[model samples]
Target chain A: MGVIHVTDRQGQRHTLECVEGWRVMEIIRDWGLPIEGVCGGACECATCHVFIAKDWVEKLDPATDEEEDQLDTVITHPTSRLSCQIIWTPDLDGLELTLAPANG
Target chain B: MTDNIETDVVIIGAGPVGLFAVFELGLLDIKCHLIDILPKVGGQCAELYPEKPIYDIPGFPMVTGQGLVDNLLAQIEPFHPTFHFNEMVESVEPIGTPEAPLFRVRTAEDGTTFTCKAIIIAAGGGSFQPKKPPMENIEAYEGTGVFYAVRHMQMFRDKRVLIVGGGDSALDWTVNLQPIVKRLTLLHRRDAFRAAPHTVEKMRALVAGGDMDLHLGQVTHLKGKAPVLEGVEIKKDDGSIVSVDCDVVLPFFGLTMKLGPIANWGLNLHENLIPVDTEKFETNVPGVFAIGDINTYPGKLKLILSGFHEGALAAQKVHRYVYPDKKLLFQYTTSSTSLQKKLGVTA
Candidate 1:
């Protein structure tokens, strides 16, 4: 099990406990943090967009082309990523990220 | 105005669940008309990810999103369901009493009205609309100096236009509108594009020839008063802010699902999902049913298979509304000759 720090749109931070093999999106959504994850972790919808902390950016695997394509559809920052693409692991125990602005 | 379309049932969405509802409702002799905001059917399957593989569909071991949609379309072929595409359902007003409920459904695009005895809200995640960037005061310029979709190309003739995003809509418009527009600028966050290779090639050719301007950046601010855009401030990738002058801004950032007008339909909503009973899958309002991902109940799973079951059960209750005087006899296509005939499989 690992824990992830999530900052929601309102700038409120919440630490969520997550099990391994679960996507970060599922963890955030299970904790009721307002992440849409509309496509149910299929990486089809960019509703689960997030910004990884600069320190932890290099700790995760690089996003695939498919994930990047989905990210192109939304207003993205330099650290923008679809949280669904990030799988929870013990190495990411204290991963910190902020939720992207909700798409209108 | 044309006459309001009269039907036994009016399905709000043309998604997989909506398509399956036609099969169930048709078996009970309930004719249906489906309305979708998209130009084509298969809602998210067709729009979001058509090629994505899906498992857990009861019979098929594995099927693509579009594959399941095609099979559902073929399975419900005998019903000959009427579809009104490119139309968003605007309002649903109950026009009948509680015992015998009827509804007057209206669409936003053409004001098309449908009067039906029963309504099946199979709209999964509401209606798909163009994704709007979360820019301050951007809504003020909508329909004036900012457009999500191009209804007419002539309106942009000889005008300075700025297109945003790296997807097909942005690249296609950049290439197509370059010829007519006095000046065209394409702005994107990254150097790489997610659009079709051919469309990207054409856009590159135009840029190479100096027909249009291409900038790797994102729009930071809309520089204009409400309803009249004079220019825009862009944050380039190199950390430099630049201002580009243009008459209109078109941001094609793909689509997003919104609850839209469904929230104002007087139905009880629990976090954007209609709470339904486990038995009928009907909403709090009589004669109006909510199924698929749009509905919530005890142990709801939001799976495609779960939606199929909800639709089948909902149809049984819909039969009660459409044919209250008649008795509903349980029959199966495997054994009942009448059911076989309804499926057009009489042997």
Candidate 2:
């Protein structure tokens, strides 16, 4: 099992165990983080938006068109991505990201 | 204000679970009227991801979100369940005793009232409201200089307006309101838009013709005082901060679910979900029931299948409250001709 680091809205960093094939959203939500993941990984809702660390942004696959469409619905950063779109794998070990502010 | 309508059951949502509850309750001769805040039924399935495929539904290996909702609507068609669309339940007053429960449910839009013996809240993740932007103090300008939804276009006539977002609402309003507003500006995070191509084309034509403004940025601050007119500060993608003077700002981000008036209904809420008995799925209130994602139990799984089971069991107990003196018998639709007749299917 690999591990992923997530920063909550409160700016507290938490390291969570990552299971293979699980979305980063599932990992953050399983660990009881404040990520909404409202659409349950369908990538329909942008509630699970996160900002990937600048260095780690290039390691992951680019966000798909469908993911970009959802991201357009919310305030996004250059590194912003829907955590549900980032499937966990061995290569993604040590990934770090911060939760986006909760949209009102 | 119209005459208060009387029904045996008033379902507070028209989602898949609420639609299924109509089928379960119908088998026991319980009539139902459903109310929803959305203009159409299907709740999250229709609103959030109608095109997304779902594979967990029984019998069907895979179906789109809207597909399941359509089938559920067809499944309960025989019951002829009445639906009140574009309405929200504002208040639920218990008008009867604990033994024989009765409630007067009122809606916000039209103030329609329904007196029912059983109330089923199948609201999945609560009511969907407009998703506000993350700007601080934006709430202070709500309904004044800032509006999430445009109820009256005349209110914006001759006013400087700033519309934010790349979606249809923003694009549509930008195109439609430009002709009326003194000056209109559309602010988006990126140059690309997810709205309809034709609408985007229209907005581009307006921008090209110098009829309005298009800025590639996000709103960073609201310059207006509480419920007053002013402008906004936008942070451009190029790290430049720009200010736009406007009388009104309309941000059409999207919709998010929130536990609205349900929190004031006096039911015991645990983290926005109503605690229900595993056996009946009824809320703390005797006649009021909570099913689907809105209700929590010992091992409640917020799956469509789990909600179907909850609706079926809840309907059984609801039959007890609706028809206290009538004896209920368990029967199967495959063998029981009486049950088959209720389903409108018989040899």
Chain A TM value for model 2: 0.98
The candidate that achieves the highest DockQ relative to the unseen native structure = 1
In the range B1-347, model 1's lDDT, one tens digit per residue, is 95599999999999999999999999999999999999998989888879988889998999998999999999999999999999999999999998899999999988989999999999999999999998779999999889999999999999999999999899988888999999999999888998899999999998899989999878889988788999999988898999999999999999999999999999999999999999999999999999899999989998989989999999999999999999999998889999898888996
- Tell me, by TM-score, which candidate is best: 1
Chain B: TM-scores of all predictions: 0.98, 0.98
Interface RMSD of each: 1.0, 1.1
What lDDT tens digits, residue by residue, belong to model 2 across residues B190-309? 899988999999999999999999999888889967789599998899989999999999999889998899999999999889999989999999999999999998887889999999
Candidate 1: residue B295 lDDT (0-100): 96
The 10 consecutive residues of candidate 1 chain B with the worst lDDT sum are B217-226
Native contacts present in each candidate (fraction) = 0.76, 0.76
Instruction: Sum up the clashes in candidate 2.
Output: 0
Query: In candidate 2, which residue ranges exceed 4 Å CA deviation?
Result: B345-347
Kindly list the per-residue Cα lDDT of model 2 for residues A22-86, writing each as its tens digit: 99999999999998988889888799999999999999999998998898888888899999999
| Candidate 1 runs further than 4 Å off | none
